[model samples]
Target: MSNAKRALQTEDLTKIEVFSDPQLSPDGNFYSYVSTKANDKDDYNSQLFVQSLNGDTPVQWTFGDVKNSNLRYSPDGKKAVFQSTRSGLPQLWLLPTEGGEARQLTTFKNGASNPTWSKDGKFIFFHASLDKDDDIQNQKEASKEERQKEQEDKKKQPLIVNRLKYKSDSSGFHDNKRVQLISLNLESNTFTQLTNNDADHGFQDVSPDGKQVLFAANLNENADYELSNDLFLLDLQSKEYKKLTDGNGGYHSASFSPSGDKVVSFGDEYEYAGATLTEIYVFDLASGERTCLSKSWDMQLGDLMIGDTRMGQSETGPVWSKDESSLFFIATDYGATGLYKVSLNKELTTLYKEDNHVFGFSYDQDKEAFVLGISSATNPCDFYYLKNDGTLTKLTKSNDAFLNEVAIAEPETLSVKAEDGKEIQGWLLKPYGFTEGKKYPFVLEIHGGPHAMYGQTFFFEMQLLAAKGYVVLYTNPRGSHGYGQEFVDACRSDYGGGDYKDLMTAVDYVLENYSFIDEDRLGVTGGSYGGFMTNWIVGHTNRFKAAVTQRSISNWLSFYGVSDIGFFFNKWEHGLNLLDDPAKLWEISPLRYAENVETPLLILHGELDFRCPVEQGEQLFITLKHLRKEVEFVRFPGANHELSRSGKPAMRQERLNHICRWFEEYL
Candidate 1:
């Protein structure tokens, strides 16, 4: 392996291409997907591609440097509409399936994305942020002079906030704009706004008969404080809407049945807030009753956990069976994300179980087949056709050129009992050029979200660390998904408690079994929640020689007001609001124990990170520096919380350099 090709480097990320957003055509004869690759400028670019059902190389349907995504074929299957950034702002673009030059469709000033086709193909539905009082005419034909005036006006005006949530981690300051669901009449060349709410309305699926459109919206009075949304159906003719969900839980992934009489929903009752396991539900349109189909399945549905390497946007569809007897959806179980089949009568079946990640899939009802976007630890992701009998046929190799040039280390999956005897799952990646008996440095990699799981998905950061001759260890601790509801809710209100112990136990088990690990040369690093744990670990114990925390929380008290979700997330995870108990928030915070930290710590954060906020890192850095503890802080200027995963290429490479340098120097 060593002589065949070199190991992966930080810059190799540019060569790593990804394919996602698999969409089945109306005739079940073609499957469309999005492919992303680095442009000559080193910035990432995505394009749309389609392949025939008879196993052929996918035809690149769209071209140019700009990104083209959110693809959906028309009802006639002759044309496709997608979102692209070719117009400076992401707008709708139309392309012919037969092949031709793609043409621009919508030219909205705020941009249009996530395009969905109406059953009749007369109109296309999409989501876009529009000014509160602005309509279709106000956006498209706006003069360039007017836009220039608005930009100058913004420069001369003061920034204002009028809503409970004014900014988010994904998009910066949310002005007076609201993301609403709208329909574009292809024939009339006019736009119809279906939703007029202050909150965001995400379009899900349209009815088979094209009478209604299904969508999810958190229409509560205080949606910012509550983690709940209701499934609603909009009348296409009358332009009226009716709520389906009780607005108790955060229901999402709502899709109509083939008969259009019911909708299959994927979400939880918020039994454990954000950590609650996702369940499949069937809501009858006529009776207005919802049935929980996977109440007893005990596994989380869909991919909630995150990895450092995953690219491309994949569609989430709870596709109805041709006969409408069952619903198929994605399930994150253990180390694999696979397709799950659940019947209306509560019967459950593992449709496509594999030790890999099923990021997305498209069902071909007529052909009784599916095109799944699947990948393993060694593969990024590609389209695979799954026949009715459960056989998989590879469709694309977007990353083959890069993967073939670099050797990837497959980690050894291991299971061990935690401090409480509850089993924990983890993996250990040996350093490149590893020897049987040579001792080597080990780094315990913690994942963020404490709720997010680490499993079969490929992680670029972990592989890069392994390539640099550092054994990388990552595990799904107590609060991680893929496990049951109880296991996921274990870490709530007990942050840095059982979850921390489970991680420490995972490390102890690896060290004891893997005799080649140098116990004293141990190091730890994590981002977000993992960052919180790294901070907690250093403060509580000095076992590790060095630590790096990225976009982590240092003090919950201040975090409650700064982070984008800080206001409500604290209440959900810790069961304590700022007014309820400020002391407990600080008690669990790593900043409270800042004086106890002695490990040489390196802090990495994005200045624009409103999730954990750079302030969280600032407090920790200042506190440790004043205490005379060895520490350094590196902040990225225009980056966000997702810097490590999808930030600028240059910044990502520099981040990796800082991480390697800190670990190399201290450990």
Candidate 2:
């Protein structure tokens, strides 16, 4: 076998590292991405690397023993701004475009990050939590009698914030009101506050004209409503802010149109029932009217924000052409995500379509070309540019060295009639070097979001499993996105019912049609909702010999009390408040069916994961041990729910290793 094939066949999970966060330079002359390297002690050292569009060797931009991420080019493309923890805390730093000594932009008692430059490049905007005493120390000290009187008034008027879902992924619930938007003047080397209210104003996007800032803020009247976030426009000149949209629903991650005539943002229009469906809305500043863009296109916009990170959803907000008459965006309606162009007349045209994933588009008007980040089941993401005449050019080949040695598996799309007579679409990856009429063990991999879909991208964990001689089957099931609203919402309040049957039907079809799949030696695994389903599946049936659940929710009651999103999910998924129906929550929990599980199971969790805490894994492990069922538990320290996608490189490698080890032992 060739060396590339041999490297793909190797089972040593640590031999390879994953690359992500691909950022295109403003001028489209270069591309940058984060490369994570792991050491023998499982310590992850990440750095930034930049490569030119001419496909030259990538130049390492950041040299560090610490984590450096969020590499972004300045508006004029003269500097690169990024966040680094080399000083023990993540701080914003600026590096010269031509390469020079990096200068720290902000020095606060706490960390500062997410730096964005203004359109004219006169000022740099970022978010930070300055020490509270600094804001008050400037006030002239009055007499002791006056100070005592002011202190008494301060005690009477305490900071009050009313908002739901305040807790974020990395930052826990914060009531002290620390996050705010601040701007740094490049000429004077001074810092000034742009937003200083009690509410947390996350920096979303700056207007094309640099006169206004768009952000997501919770300035609602109700503190417990799980409504959508409203978009607000902060006028930089007037120093005044006004609400852009009203009612129950909210908006997030807005971007100005090329002409600055309209604003586009992504979020759901909430109903009394719950969040109806997420879509892209374009608000015209002149007419003061909002129009849903994705409504006519029959696609749901997921994670429409400006960033290089591959999380939440792969799709970004609309990318306008130079003339501003057409927009380009990524959609997965055609079975795979591809670059699509939408004209201002509401006409849609496909620019590129393939089974692989195409996302992150940056259009260059002068060159009349666009650069996009592309990947597939066997290919990791790399920068690619498309000419006006449809010619394609690869800008960087970051993974070619590693992929040359790996025996990668290609996914074959399959269509099967579900048990309910509805057509279901999925992909199957056969084991490497497969032969006809030979039965092999199979794994039914499930995706999280229950609302999220599995695309034709390179999944490291799935590829590793296929390399280990197992046919991997993954489908969008009912609750997955890419389909219409009805299909995505099909699993609401009906978990482990229709979605479970859909997966089982997929397994049945694979076993009957694919002669290479072993029926009796099957396995199941997933995380989050998928993890919940794995727990639910093992309890209901003994068809599988082994199962693994990662960041799962075993008990709904405990999850409701501990999870950061539990309060919102409990009502949306189950339509029951914790106080309204605690018993009902327990009834739907996977732990209630623990007595029926016969499959040897493995539980994986992250220590710092508040979304699905490690306690859930602990509960399941202890229960299975007491019941004398074969089970093992693994916990990753300092990791979050996004372990597979954006967690520490070393921990992510360990996660994949543990999963393969468990399956190799029993399957």
- lDDT, candidates in the order shown: 0.86, 0.75
TM-score of every candidate: 0.97, 0.88
lDDT of 1 by residue, 22-113 (tens): 99899988788888877877577888878887888888877888888888888899998988888777899898878778888887877898
Cα lDDT of model 2 overall? 0.75
After superposition, candidate 1 runs with Cα above 4 Å error: 1-3, 141-155
Native-to-model Cα distance after best TM-score fit, residue 646 in candidate 1, in Å: 1.0
Number of the top TM-score candidate: 1
Weakest lDDT window of 10 consecutive positions for candidate 2: 304-313
- Angstrom error of the Cα, residue 257, model 1: value is 1.2
Q: List, in order, the clash count of every candidate structure.
A: 0, 10
Candidate with best lDDT: 1
Off by over 4 Å in 2: 1-4, 7-28, 39-41, 131-168, 173-177, 221-227, 271-276, 303-315
